[model samples]
Target chain A: MENNNVEILLIEDNKNDAELAIRAFRKANLNNHLIHLKNGVEALEFLFGTGKFDVRDISKKPKVILLDLKMPKLNGLEVLAQIKANEQTKAIPVVVLTSSKEHPDIKRAYALGANSYIVKPVEFDDFSKVVTDLGFYWLLKNQPHV
Target chain B: MDNKEKTIELIIANKKLAFQNQEKEKRAHELVSANKELAFQKKEKDKRAAELLLANKELAYQNEQKDKRAAELVLANEELAYQNEQKDKRAAELILANEELAYQKELKKKRASELSNSNKEVDDLEKRVKERTEDLESFSYSVSHDLRTPLRAINGYAKMLEEDYGTVLDAEGLRFLGEVRSNANKMGVLIDDLLTFSRLGRKGITKSTVDMNMLLETVLSALNQSMTHNAEIKFSNLLLAVADYNLLQHVLTNLLLNAIKYSSKKEKPMIEIKSEQKNGEIIYSISDNGVGFDMQYGNKLFGVFQRLHDDEEFSGNGVGLAIVKRIIDKHDGNVWAVGKEGQGATFYFSLPDNDK
Candidate 1:
């Protein structure tokens, strides 16, 4: 992929959730060069061009990163911090997505430079629509630095 | 004639001289008697002069003794004057010391009464705490026994629907059956959460200072990994707070879940989570840009199975907020929410200082 050419970089851990999100994006017809990473570690490596993702061009940052706040290693907020703190990946819009808004760290994630935040709906239909609409907005409407 | 007369004269002269001598003797005897009388008178005068002299010397001696006595009286008077001044000062000191003793006695009495009153107050407080603990135990028992009976009925009936009628039911019928089962499952979740909440009341809280910032991060990660929400959440100023590490985690998890569920329909939902200090309590709040309800439904928001939104709009048995409220109340805290219809909602909960 060319540098700065990717859109909708999703950093989620659960396979079920990742599949559901991909299906939602396809239904909305907003699927672009969407890349899915299983955890925050992979997400960071992809962005900073390190770890297993060192082969990718460092400059090809995603326009919008949909980040899950929870993952096994280097969870969402830590990933967000690494992204937001670095000048190289600071411009990319990071949208926090989680199941519980009650998670106390939701606020901190935003303070650490999360661009947006969302809670997943338990109902399948609502979840699909939320996913589809959010894909469209962040991927199409949001303009990132080229 | 002269010769004859001379002879006669001589005789006469001699006779006259003899007579004169006789008279002279008589005169001498009288003069001698008078001289003896004068000598007696002179002796009396000399005796009176010696007596007057002796009387004058006695008066002079008495005068000297009076002078000495007067001088001794002046000295005695001066000693008495000095003694009187010393006695006055000693008397004044005694009076002041007596007054001080009285004042000290009054102070000691006051302190004794105050100490007794304070001891009584402490006894009352201890009694009240024991009573409260007993009440919580009974409440937990009620939750365990009384509440579960209804739950068992609902769950049993739903299971019967699927197992017994699976062959006879059509597609839509089966779908409805599925809803019944799921609703029952949801009720089971509600009951479980309620049990957890009530158990918190009876359970002695082992509180330790929690790093809330880290706890929140961990909770958020778990929430995100388990579920998916597309809305962008923005937050700030999440600080470390003191609370029961596990209980607070549960509180945050429930609140955040409610915010996510309620705000599902917004074009672009936004959730904000933060903490603040209020009235000496730690208040954690979650605000969401979602389909909020009217304030009228606010009263029932934290009630068990009390839901404002229809099942079609939001699927919850309304036990989540109740559980949150219970946990907070157990921690000697409070939980409340503020929202307007079609706008956003903010839920606030406060945890009191640790009871340790």
Candidate 2:
């Protein structure tokens, strides 16, 4: 937890799914200072240094943000728009994870500067592999200007 | 002459007497001749005057008759002139009418040509539609085959896990493996249905006079396994129809199976299979006393994999109605359903008179 520059920030409402994603990240050996926010609202508060994460340094933005579209309040698209709109968080990459490939707003998410899109796999093993691959690609492979 | 005169006197007297007598006789004769000549001239003059008078009267009568005839001729000429004018007017009107008829004929000719052009366009469109339909069938077939291969892999591995490594797996892991198997099986069913639908589109239908009553009976007998409940299936006097027998059988089986499946929840499910002839079309209906669907999803009923009821409530892949629709379409017929939620559903299919 020392020098906590969050490398992977996962914003998901479902606790089981969040736990599973974390497990997959660990299995892929790409887990490095990962933070799981319950929903878009918490993720926004964390990024802007408000609400529960007021003491957090806004300059130390996560390298990658994995967003779930269907959450309780403040959906992924709104969170993505807010993040990309701000100059401080604009460079951070956002990947959208959705349940339905036919979700109407997928194209809109890409238009609003989403880095990637992946359909949530129903099977557990496939889900884990997809999550691992995405973590690895964003965290290690792509050299983003911090 | 004196002596002779005296003697002549006596003689003269006698001669005078003779002379007188002669003179008297000559006078008498002259008188008589003059009278005769005057009388003759007077008579001739009178006859000539009478002849002139008669000729003048005859000429006057002839002149009067000619005047009358002249007046009549003028009147007749005037009548003929008026008749000629009327005839000219009629001829002019007739000419205008003929011109109009000719114009109309030309217009009709142009219209006929335009119709012919449009008919050709329609034919071209129909040809394109047929070609596209063929392409779609082949595509669907290829998709089905391709999709099944992956599904088989998924199913095979899951089965292998269960069969080969069942002892090593925990209870929850085994349950998860079962779900995987079931889902794969569902995918297999979906692929099979898609193949059936594609095949139906490609197959050329041969129609013959089919006994519908007998056909329904046969279909019912085939579906003997579906009749768990003592469902009363009543068939009225159904007339014969001209349709593709095999395809029609498929339609009936689908409907009958749906009836049985949906109505299994009813205390006593009553299915009434009836027929009616209207406007040269035979309508066959199957009504089931069952837990039916809402009317809002009516339009989506015949679409592939469009299910109104949840998988927990009714076990179906939702391709049955779509198959029924395709078959009915091939037979040049229509199919529809009317249902209320928690009530019942009546499925109707009509066959056009093959006499046409």
Candidate 3:
């Protein structure tokens, strides 16, 4: 059970939202390599292979990081800044997943090298569509530096 | 007689005659001396009379001068009296003016204090309104996320149920699921609109010179893409305005969309867009030959959640005009509508003319 081959790293605080996003990906048959971290600390800890994830390989980064803006302990923007600032993780595309467009950190997220931004829709169908579409475009269509 | 006396008494009487002659001579001498004295006295009297005459002339001249001096004094006294009267009049006017000035100063002081009090009240009111608007904004914003979170779950689960369990359920069950999804979606829109309405107070407007004609073109194209309608929107040489571009676009889109929807049933639904300059404002009017409302419900047209037509007749969440009103109000503009039952309606919004 190697966790090194993760593709989509979903960093969200709310359990329901995390499950829904996973479900949305699963519905689209794109949840094969997705990993869900409950908080920003865990995501960072998982990404840099530090503390609990020290033994894990840091080189095997996810294809895209789905970062939520509002979370407990080292929120999304800070996590994004750390990811973008590092030499090894800077190439990994980071997508901002926010609850509302009214989240004032929208501009700052982009400024911190977020690859894209998506507002989680209210309707499940639209939400599903958005999740699947991003999966398809980023995983299949978008080419990243190897 | 003296010679006879002198000769007669010759001899012895000669001596007596000589003595008598001597006495007579002495008497003559005394008479001569007295005559001389008389002459001298007469001369002295004549000189005294001349001196008296000169003194009399001097007295007459003095009397004449005194008379002239008395006349001059009378004239001077009259002048002094006139001057005193004038000075008295001036003093009376000065007293009246001083009282008036004091009264004016008191009035000015009172007015200044009143002005400051009202200004303070106005400042307090503005602060409260700002705080309340901010509260409402943050409330709606968070509610959008919080409410939508559960709503998404419900809608998603319902959708997942439909996709996964559609084969096991009846057709009625699928329809109910559809209803649920749509109602959730509508609630989402309503929440979004509420958020936008509250946000108007917090968002600062970035103003620019807007070409009305160009703005209408952009709006028409946008409206065309959003919904398909056959309403002929006409405008030419529309006036320009200095306002927030995006907010004004929002106002136009809502009004035009409403116009098209309200008039959809008409054979030839026509919408005329026009702009005119009036009273330091540029008023743009959108007239639609739609299923207009009774003029009685006109005031309610711009209220939040206020609808003249039922949901079945016109599909709307009743927030378009309210949004329009708020945007216009943020620009210090006015919005109103005039309609008659079943005839037509005219919606007008005016913005301050800052172009020139």
Candidate 4:
């Protein structure tokens, strides 16, 4: 809620998946500035500085967002549509994480301007690798619009 | 002179009177004859008049008969005219009836075409149902992801536990955790195999000329890369197959792996693969000299998750043969197996001889 910059905004409803991703990022030292929102509506409010996050600075946005497709209330695709359609948050790279590689919504996510896509594999090692790699890419490797 | 004259006169007179008397007598006889002739002529005239009257009466009778004939001819002409009109009406009805027959024939032709169109519609409906089936299969594929999510969490947590607290936990505790992780991994494999089998149903087979030798070589090389096997694989006279190459490759991989896996315990593991032309089909067989199964359980050979042997004896998910069966079924082929306990198992699959 204060004036600062966040790196990765992970919007995943599942707690265990979120905890595992956090542990993965923490192990890779990428969780210091990472923000975890439980659902899509909360994520939208956080991004736009509305609702509970109204007191937060709207200009200071995350470098990248890890969006999950299936969620309560406004789903990831809907959240993604709002992000990409808005000029304020559209430049922040949104990498969509899906539970399945063969998900039909992944295509729709991309079509709605998702920067990248990753399937959350069942194996811990694979899930860890995907999380850390995505953290590193968005935080270190990728050049932001700013 | 007087006396002579008188005497002469008297004699002449007397002679003249006698001649006149004789003439009168002759005249009287002639008169009688003439009168008889006149009477006979009158009788003849009367007979002629009666004949004339009779002929006149016959002529009148003939005239009356001619009049009756004329009236009958007029009546016959009217009847003929009425008959001609009736014939014309019948001719008109015949023409109308012929037109009706022609129209009926045209209607029949239209009905046949309509029937063919309806048949086409039925085909379209079948195609739509197939598409919907594929759609549902794809949906299940996505549903499989949701199933794996929780599975991933379970496996991930255990893995995290081992990674973070393995040094603190006892050896037995670590083994228990390992069991949990392995079973989760096994479930994951089952899910994947089920997906693969379901995906096979949705796959549209694109068949081409496939070199079985190359296919076998590819499969063999892939098998070599995966695990170290002691089995001797022998395949000879493998016929060139007309099939979906990738599918055939899948079929080969599953069966060959089965042969190697089952026969791994044998001192001399032998795997034989052969393809031959028989009964308008390209019959392919893979025989393994391994821990074979009983012939009684042969009915469940190609069933999904239908295992003949225990997992402890044979490490299999019971989907290889099922997958092989499905691939063969897609190719309009057959799959069967023959085996006896401790002897061996021979798995056979045949593809239709498309060239023939």
Candidate 5:
């Protein structure tokens, strides 16, 4: 994995979801610079350049962070709070992608400074379209803070 | 003196000088005897006078005792008369007190009856609200659990099939697959909207002084991001309202989105928002130059799943206006609309101005 140029960080715990999201990105040809972190702990470790990713460059921040709310350890809201709290990672666009739209954490996610929120559609095509569209919007259209 | 003269004449007839002397002696004796008699009579008179004086003293003492007894009787009579007057006054006071007590009892009876009637009304209202809430809760539960899970599976598996067998399938097959996926997606939206409607019924409103201008601006920015429309919305110096911030946001979003969607076909889609104070209520209106509905079906506009236009013309699940109606009703407000067939439409709602 080229850690220096990682553009999209997908923090998802479910194996099927990770695979589906990766496939969707690949279909849209946006998977080349994407990194899939299975849990929040590893996501934090990778972002901070600690633990197993200690040797990688820490300054290379992803253009967008696709976070899932429910996880086994250090759920998305906590991770989001940590991310937004740090000046180094505060500018990164964090999009909360979740299965349930009515999850009580949605408002909390927005309150915690998530840039955008999207409910993961059950249909594969719609999910794929959403991912592709978000990739295009954040990567191709939006101007990142320098 | 005449009796002595007669005795002397009888005695003097006997002898001249001697007889006359004896007669004189006899007359002298008789005079002495008469003097004695006179003295005894005087003594008796003196005793009678003493007895009369004792009788008079006894009568004076009796008169004194009678006068004393008569004074005591007069005092006793005066005391009895005073007690009778006091008793009459006390009886009159008791009569007035009894009348006042009876009046108070009558007032209490009337007040108790009114309270009982109000309690009955409150009990009936509570029962009706509870029944409707229970029905809404059960329906929401079923929609959330039974409906959504299967819809998820359907949509998920359909996508899997399309992904796994896309190369082998022809164009028509892909199109059919697309339809299935879209329909499933539509069903998901419908379920979501239904859940939102049901939740509004159960959710308690958290009130605050909401700045309508700021709230509308935020909603407009959000809508601008979600969809593209060419409607000129107008509002300035909007009034602040005390309401639930999030619920009011939902209300504004629905009305504004509807206005934009219905007026999308117009050459110049115009949406004007204005507010006025009327009869202790703040009335807010959103007017749009849209494809309006007939007044005949106006009563049915806010019903769930009641649509005025076909899906080809304007697409919606028709739960938006119902949610708006419910939110307004929760605020103790009223919602209504005025429109002609193809000219334009105006939606009006009033919230109680309780700040004053």
Candidate 6:
């Protein structure tokens, strides 16, 4: 529940896709202290300790943010721009995971300082594998700036 | 001298005086004659003076007439010289006009040749565009074909539900699973159609004499084995076509399959295949007494993913004709169709008779 202890922050609008990603991370034993926010608004609020997360520590940032491109309010790119613009959150690694490889947002995400981009596969097994691999890579393999 | 002589000889003088009177009478007669001669001479001189005056007046009148003639000649000579000058100026203008005409003719020649050169350039550009389009088609073909792997995986996982979770699933859950599987299968078919369509764009034609009779036999038998239909198929004396064997087979398969599919609703479906040689090309036709489409939308028949009939009425992803069109285009051939609603449809394609 505490923001300081969160290692993975997933901002996804689709409940089923979020569940699948969580299951993938759990299967890889990388879901400990994982936080799932339904939209970019909630993700931004949680990151900056505003709104519902007002009492949480603002100094603490997730090890990585898994962003989805298409969302209801405040899309992934906007959230990415905000994250990269802020001095405190700019150093944290952000990965973009979306359904289409041809999505135009992929380039923009990287341009906005996204560390990695992964296309979510249509098949459940491949999707699971990709999510699990990327989770492991970010949480364990990659060295955080903090 | 007579007085002194008279005094001395008075008596002798009487006889001398008679002789002198006689001589004096002779001398008077001679003097009268001379005076008459002188008067005649004076009359002759007066006549000569009057003749001289008349002659002088006539000469003066002739002189005046000559002077008028000389002045008229001088004016005539000056007018001739002015006319000569005008003629010279006209000759100079004529030379300039001829030069201008020659320059215009040369310019026209240059323009005509330039137009022809640009026309040839346009043709070359068109050829290059066709080559580039073929390359792009092949690239997309590979990309779409490679997309099949993930699609297959998706379908496989969706199908795995029946075997793995069949016991725990309710009817609705099973239906949902079926929908997912079917949608994945549909996507797979679409991708395959896209690949086929794109492949036709790049596939080179291998020309060979194909026996239509045998090809139809093989295609019909293969189709029959795959699907059952009470359709009467007919073909006779089919002409040979010089084309790529595999591509020709693909075209026939698509056409025949279309015929069978559309006519399936009829009580007795009839499909006919015919061929003829005309205009240095072999025209092949496939006719079916099926639910034909409206002729208005004929132009869109060969377009990618373009369907005239509803997906519910006919199950097609609409890429079959597009593939046919691409193949025919690659062969430098043409394909067209004629159809009437509820009557029948006939598809025709022509291949160049290079073998002949």
Question: What DockQ do the predictions score, one after another?
Answer: 0.02, 0.01, 0.65, 0.45, 0.20, 0.04
lDDT per residue (tens digit) for residues B213-288 in model 6: 9999999899989899899999999998888888989999999999999999999999999988899898999999
Please write out the lDDT profile of model 1 over residues B1-356, one tens digit for every residue: 79889999988998999899988998898889888888977888888888888988888888888898889889888989988998899889889988988998898899889888999998998899889867765665455434443443444454455566878889899888677657756755565666665565556666678877788788889999989987676666675566678888888888788788888777787888888776677778889988887998899999877889888878877777887887777778888989999898999888774432
Order of all candidates by TM-score, from best down to worst?
3, 4, 5, 2, 6, 1
> How well does candidate 6 reproduce the true complex, by DockQ?
0.04
- Chain B alone, TM-score, model 5: 0.64
Residues B34-55 of candidate 3: C-alpha lDDT, one tens digit per residue: 9999999999999999999999
Q: Per-residue CA lDDT of candidate 4, range A1-146, in tens?
A: 23356888999999999999999999999988989999999998998999998888878889899998888789989999999999999999999987876676877888999999888888888889999999999899999998
The TM-score of candidate 2's chain A against the true chain A comes to 0.95
Per-residue lDDT of candidate 5, residues B145-210 (tens digit): 456556656676678888789999999999998888888888888888888887887788989999
TM-score winner between candidates 1 and 3: 3
Q: Against the hidden true structure, what lDDT does model 2 obtain?
A: 0.84
lDDT for residue A129 in candidate 3, whole number 0-100:
87
Residue B45, candidate 3: Cα error in Å is 11
How much is B223 displaced in model 2, in angstroms? 2.7
**lDDT (tens digit, per residue) of candidate 2 on A66-137:** 998878779899999999999989899999987544355778999999989886654555677899888888
- Give the clashing residue pairs of candidate 2, or none: B2-B5, B4-B8, B5-B9, B6-B9, B8-B12, B9-B13, B11-B15, B12-B16
Better of 3 and 5 by DockQ: 3
User: On a 0 to 100 scale, what is the lDDT of residue B11 in model 5?
Assistant: 69
What TM-score quantifies how close candidate 6 is to the native fold?
0.49
Candidate 1 chain B: worst-modelled 10 consecutive residues by lDDT? B144-153
Candidate 4 global TM-score:
0.66
How good is model 1 by TM-score?
0.41
Provide the interface RMSD of candidate 3 in angstroms, 1 decimal place: 1.3
Q: Which candidate is the best by TM-score?
A: 3
True contacts kept of 4: 0.64
User: Which lDDT values do the candidates have, in the order given?
Assistant: 0.77, 0.84, 0.89, 0.89, 0.88, 0.84
Single out the weakest 10-residue window by summed lDDT for candidate 3 chain B: B3-12
TM-score of 5: 0.55
Which of the predicted structures, 2 or 3, would earn the higher DockQ when compared with the native?
A: 3
